[model samples]
Target: MPMPASYPTYVPRKQFTQYLDDYVSHFKISPRYHRSVESANYDEGTRKWYVKVRNVSSDEIEEYHGRFLVVATGETTDAFIPEVEGLNSFTGEVLHTTQVQIGKGI
Candidate 1:
């Protein structure tokens, strides 16, 4: 995750990265590191999504498939992360439904 250095008071960046590595390992989520996703398409017959990915180092393009996809394309200038001190203890999960939309090419 080529994210530049960030240091939060509660956890050092290295320790945070270690935790991230452990979590990804435990979940069996093998991230396609150092790759750029050019586009994605869904196969209606197979009900799976295929993505065109390019290796940042060699510029080789390859296709990958998955049943579901989570598109977290980094920059979130419009995304807001509000700081509500006691919000964490309140519930299981909080979703702002109004901010979500479900559709093709959305």
Candidate 2:
């Protein structure tokens, strides 16, 4: 999705977060946070996507059907750091993509 014109060229972390919150609220999008997808399968006959999601907190599983299913992992979940030779010896700072703050010398 294109960024809104009102957004500054270098949007701050909080501002970007607020923009997302506003967009979701304005669009009445229902996002299920903290839920893990157990399975996702597309049905050609019905042309719909069937997905099974499990709530991480309550351990409850639920089924959902939709025209589209988005799998957005990684950034919402834990950051993975692969082991590299001499990484510990390096003096430079290491930050994940999600940890980067725009216009802050990232």
Candidate 3:
């Protein structure tokens, strides 16, 4: 049956944290401990990837090998910057969200 065109589209991540929580809950899997992924490399022979994770507190590294890799890291991890016309030439002041705020009000 043909659906109505007026039906609203359910675009996720409008409210990032809520969307992230919903996505995590949709997959009913639980892990023993939480860790941070440092890097990953593919093993062509095994058709799998070796991922390196770091324990935040002790700064210990752990490796996990798996076939499928899903990047569940949230918006806090990465940033998307658009290329503006004169962005490169303009040498005034530009800061990315990833940058740390040092001082008070500018």
Candidate 4:
């Protein structure tokens, strides 16, 4: 008996959010670590995007002007973490992708 062609096909998740964080880390570039873009405003006259980036090291702030803005700022940052019971007092292991991976990890 012949089976339908679509029987064993595979379809990957269209959204990267579905993938595990560690898996995404394998492909991240080193030299260019994550820096959250606090805000972005575009200038039509110059065709540049003025982005305010926070320096995770010294907790300083800087601005960058670029012709093209990729806006790689994923959905991770857009949402807020829930504060469950005893969440603040828990000492073991607690981490946010932003605090740990600096926003690069999915």
Candidate 5:
């Protein structure tokens, strides 16, 4: 299918990442990095949620309480594919987005 002239038809991976970085920097979106999530639990009595976060560098665990939460991890990842039956009969190989090759003869 042909894309509209205003939209992009093909964009390189590095260029795409650079565009995303530029967007973040322009908008001043400072995202926290390397804060591992240990567990998330909800309390019915208080009607709030507790998230246990552990610092990746210090290994210190701290609990954060919030009424609402959104897990925004894996913004550039492909959707999860569930297991299927008779996968051995497939002729084509499966590859993730990161594993896709670009440019040249392709």
Candidate 6:
């Protein structure tokens, strides 16, 4: 489905999340959220990926086996600020892309 014309060229995070939720619901995709991966290893003998995940809320650990494993680290998971010569000398404010909030401009 095409996005609405009211959406801007660059959709906001909340809008994008809602779109993803709608797509998941429409496709009947069951994705796990708020789970921390403790370990992921591929067994050569079984030829399968074994993943150990812990639920953040319940602190329960579960093991899952899959033929294919996809690791998706979000774009803004880590903020990187390159070290430039004389960058500290500037008195102006410096902000990273991850630190910028919607509707707030520097």
Could you give candidate 6's per-residue lDDT for residues 1-106 as a string of tens digits?
4555687889898988887777678669789889999987767678777889999999999899986665555575587766644447644355666776533433
Q: Which model scores highest in lDDT?
A: 6
Candidate that scores best on TM-score = 2
Residue pairs in candidate 5 whose N, alpha carbon or C atoms collide under 3 angstroms: none
lDDT of 5 by residue, 4-56 (tens): 24436576677667666776776697766789888766666787668899989
CA lDDT of 9 in candidate 1? 47
TM for candidate 1 is: 0.53
Q: Quick one: how many clashes does candidate 6 have?
A: 0
**Stretches of candidate 4 exceeding 4 Å from the true structure:** 1-31, 73-106
How well is each residue in 5-105 modelled by candidate 3, as lDDT tens digits?
34345434444445445555766645535688788666667877688999877789988887665444355556645555454764445455456332221
Tens-place lDDT per residue, model 1, 1-106, is 3222463546676877776776677669777788898887666688777889999999999888987655564555466545444446533244442365322122
* TM-scores of all predicted structures: 0.53, 0.63, 0.42, 0.38, 0.44, 0.50
Give me the runs in candidate 6 sitting further than 4 Å from their true place: 1-8, 44-47, 77-106
Q: Which stretches of candidate 2 lie over 4 Å from their true place?
A: 76-106
Candidate 3 all-Cα RMSD: 13.9
TM-score of model number 5: 0.44
Q: List the residue pairs that clash in candidate 2.
A: none
lDDT of each: 0.63, 0.70, 0.57, 0.54, 0.61, 0.72
Alpha carbon lDDT at 74, candidate 4: 46
Query: What is candidate 2's lDDT per residue for 12-93, written digit by digit as tens?
Result: 9998898778868866989888888887666768877788999999999999998765444356557766665445764445
TM-score of 3: 0.42
RMSD (CA, Å), candidate 1 to true, equals: 12.7
Using lDDT as the measure, what is the rank order of every candidate, best first?
6, 2, 1, 5, 3, 4
Candidate 4 lDDT over 29-102, as tens digits, reads: 23335577678666657767688988887677878887655534246645455554444654435454445443
